[model samples]
Target: MAFSTITNLDAAAAQQHSHELLDRILSTASSTYVTGPVGQGNGERVLVLGGTGYIGRALVPELARRGYRPAVLSRSAEVKNEAEYADAEVIVGDATKAADVAAAVKAAPTAVVISLLSGRKPNDVEDCRQVDHEAVVHGIKAAVANDVQQFIHISDYGVYRPELIPQVYKIQVEGELIGQHHGYVPWTIIRPTAYFPYLSVAFGDVKNGLKYRIYDHGEWNVVNPIAREDLAEFIVNQVLNDDAIGRILPVGGPWNADNTVTLKQAGEFMFELNGKTPDWEVITMASWDKKIARLGRLSKLTKQLKPVVFYLEAAKY
Candidate 1:
């Protein structure tokens, strides 16, 4: 009977089952569950790594508005004069360096440290390792050494099925925190789905009469991409809260007609927004898979083909 059940499981069912099992394991091994909010921040200093990017612009201000002292670590001092960072104390440091991360943590009495660090180049493996995996390890070590109350890591939801290089690194960082590989610091791992900008990348092309490329019927998966502002609010809500400690929260926007959509549906909506007939450049999954396989072989000989393969893999993801 067990063998029969295992054989009958479909791909989607297997994926869902895997996620359920992983969640149960993490929850049991991490911390005991607690209910209710633990009140507001009382002037706790929050050191935000990677706070000069898209989500950071919204999160820093939100943290300040909620009575938390927001300190942003940026490589550039010019951000200090930026209006978005007006409420934040800008600390000049590079996230890729362990010493810089440690100094930034010890520079002030940091109560919480949030790592929003991700690689800018998803196509580069070395960059992903340095920024996504190694940089986060730096923050984890710093947070532990400084005795920070909480370490919140913003991971990708796609780590559940890590097909891309960046996703693999995100998974590794998640493991380091959950296993206490570096040291013991109360941690919250948030796996957020695609952002609005990511899903809307093709909007401009579609508006300009370019065919929106998609695989198979583009109905393979459905996602509800969240806005940066909404995601920032959610992240702040988890800050310094006992209920959120040692939790793996998979977050997205509201599940409604407007938000929840398949890739094909997303493309159709873009066409409607631009008042144009939908012109899709649909490619079969079998052919796309073959192309990826061919490129995978070529990447071994030519390093330039690596990024091309990465992009193809990411699109399939």
Candidate 2:
């Protein structure tokens, strides 16, 4: 009888130990479910504006993977690829339209609203203003009306110093977005440097046998380009973290503080990605200035290229 009692006690201890081990393994495997103060778990509804764009396409999937339900608002009824958002709810509507924005916001009482809208071109100042500034204002009003808890606005790092003519639109929009949030709801603004895809323009001339153009020998300015997927992950992870509320976060790629890429380095990286040699041409500031001046004052191409010239010229600083 004494032996049987001891054996039963030992089996009970062994079962408890095994259960604890399983618990630890499950906790480690389910890291994404670990919620912060703002996180309401996987059932939280998130509304994403401009969800059909480059960044949004990645962001929606990342949100879904993290167990948050995401609903995307697009101007078109038919998404280019339906399977991409199989888990997300797709609402067809134009953000610029007040009614459409309201309908999407009210579609579900969202815990967070993220805006990834951007202008298609640098020279289209009116379109830029409308989409980046006005549409955001409208979206904010809609979110506010629906009692959304948080708002995340994606802005460019170039807006920090608006010396370029095209940056004015971004500057204005950033001001409106921050001003409108005004303590009513928690707002987080993310300013990201140029994305890797944006700098891939160097590849455009590569196939034509044209040497990649480098300004000031591509050594003056440095940029830390972030991958779109990484940026999307950062944004979605911050959604429910109250610590990120009202913070202006500047993010970069996985490079050390002292490690940054210049235009030449970026071009070389792209060339190497395509398994080709880095052929380069250096364009001096003086040569670029002369070319711009020769384009004449009333030329549309010149107007469109002003932002490019401004960026290259500013890089020398």
TM-scores, all models, native as reference:
0.84, 0.75
- TM-score winner among the candidates? 1
Clashes of 2: 0
Whole-model Cα lDDT per candidate?
0.83, 0.69
Error of 2 at 223 (Å): 1.2
Q: State candidate 1's TM-score.
A: 0.84
Residues 1-317, candidate 1: write the lDDT tens digits. 00000112244554455446544544554332333223467899999998998889988998988889999999999999999899888989899999999999999899999999988877778898899999999999999999999999999998887767888898889998999999999999999888856655689898889998876566666676888887888889899889899999988876555666667788999999999999999887767767877998898899999888777766665
Among these predictions, the greatest lDDT belongs to 1
Candidate 1: regions farther than 4 A off: 1-39
